[model samples]
Target: MAEYLKLGVKNEPAMSQASLGFVGRSVAVAVVEDISHNLDPNLFTALKDAALSTNPDESKQAVKAALAHGTHPEDIADFYIPALARDMGDLWCADQLSFAGVTIGVSRLQAMLRALGPNWASDNATTNENASILLIVPQDVYHTLGAIVLSSQLRRKGFSVKLFLGGKPEDIANHITRTKTDAVFISSSAGETLEKLRQIIEVIRGSSGATCPIVIGGSILDVQEIHDVTALTGADYATKLPDEALKLCGLQETEKKKISARNGT
Candidate 1:
């Protein structure tokens, strides 16, 4: 893969594994490994460029070319596309791209995933029908690429996910109540910030009481921040990765057990 890409680089094993979920002996874990190990660096570059392209057709061609080698669509959606989004974030932080450009890049990634057809999410979903999840993308925040990607991941894992965005606290709470969702998710960057997220949690809890689980995730959710989020906001689980958030909510099962999940306490 690197030979075609001409980039003598590989993400560390730990970093690669974290993007999917904690690697395990499961078939799902193995599939993630297959895609992670197979990404061509050149393909990755082209994807990044495509995502940031101003012309939608140009972006399509870039994604089309990457898959020309018979690359799995899931590999692009689940692996490379996400990596490109993060790369766009990195470039934004370095002043290489503006916020608008980054947003467009993420939109492009979503467009590519949407183009892959209906089978992609179902192919990845577990048959268990484990949990009903409310994936919230709060108002006043623009970047939803991670949430978009995470929604697909959760759907793939058998959660009936409803994505919420730009709604009032009452509306959000009402939707959760109306749908009887089992889990509520809030990313740090989803709304104004973590502090605002704390308020969202408070409002949801106030409206719903203690029945539904509130889970928090995002790039900002390191171990300490996770503890802080739960402590400060009355949230039940916090994770740095979207898939790990599922584990924290105890929505999926595997051969080994993790101790951190509170399962909505």
Candidate 2:
């Protein structure tokens, strides 16, 4: 967690050695696969060794250095999710697993902002006041890291956002009905469970009676074919992340202004 914070603040050199030890080999591999071009090999080697080390302090320092090297938020997110999920089963209270997932997801998002720099949000803000949004993920889409990261980005950009995850279709409909949401974001990482996402979208759209925007995302929709699937199922917006989806929905500027004002900038 300290590594996550250090990366977010761009205080790369300040990360404690112990924090790096928590990052695992899979995380190192993911980081390399995602950002090897931007990072030094020696730093990565140190991270890998730390991940593999039995010594707790050495491992922590190594992970800290790798994080300090910085990588894209999406890649960081991908690296953190599995590691978080594995550790969650033992660390989190049984009833709080979902909350833990949300925390892990948001932390990765902060890491992304750290790696990508804060200027990324500048390109997408809008002045429109009517650009409210709602981000919804299917009840079974337990991998909330992507959605949470996207939500954090959108919130930072000033969009009015209501994040809902892992709920029944009826619950989704009820929220849409009550909020009159301008957009709905859905995430489905499951390969075979896409039908469930479709059904929920259809149900929400049909029940809303208005042509509310629907966005679909996740590993399943990472493919071009899934874009077509999203269209076929009546999703008006589709992207791999919430930031991109908001761009598709024409709310970028409005969100940015809101964020800027909130930050007193």
- lDDT of residue 174 for candidate 1: 84
For all candidates in order, the CA lDDT equals: 0.61, 0.51
Model 1: worst 10 consecutive residues (lDDT sum): 22-31
Please write out the lDDT profile of model 1 over residues 26-118, one tens digit for every residue.
001101223446668978877766666555786678767767878877777778876666666566445455544555566677788777645
After superposition, the stretches of candidate 2 with alpha carbons farther than 4 Å from their true spots are 1-129, 190-192, 241-243, 253-265
* The candidate that achieves the highest TM-score relative to the unseen native structure: 1
Query: What are the C-alpha RMSDs, in order, of all predicted structures?
Result: 10.6, 11.8
Superposition TM-score, candidate 2 onto the true structure: 0.53
| CA error at residue 204 for candidate 1, angstroms | 1.9
Please give, for residues 1-265, the per-residue lDDT of candidate 2 as tens digits.
Answer: 3232221222224324333222211111111123334544564445433333334355445445556666444443344433433343333233222332334433443343334434333323433346656666666444555555555456555555666767788887787777656677776553425566668878887778856777776665544475576766667765665556777776676566766887899
lDDT of 1 at 115: 70
TM-score of each: 0.71, 0.53
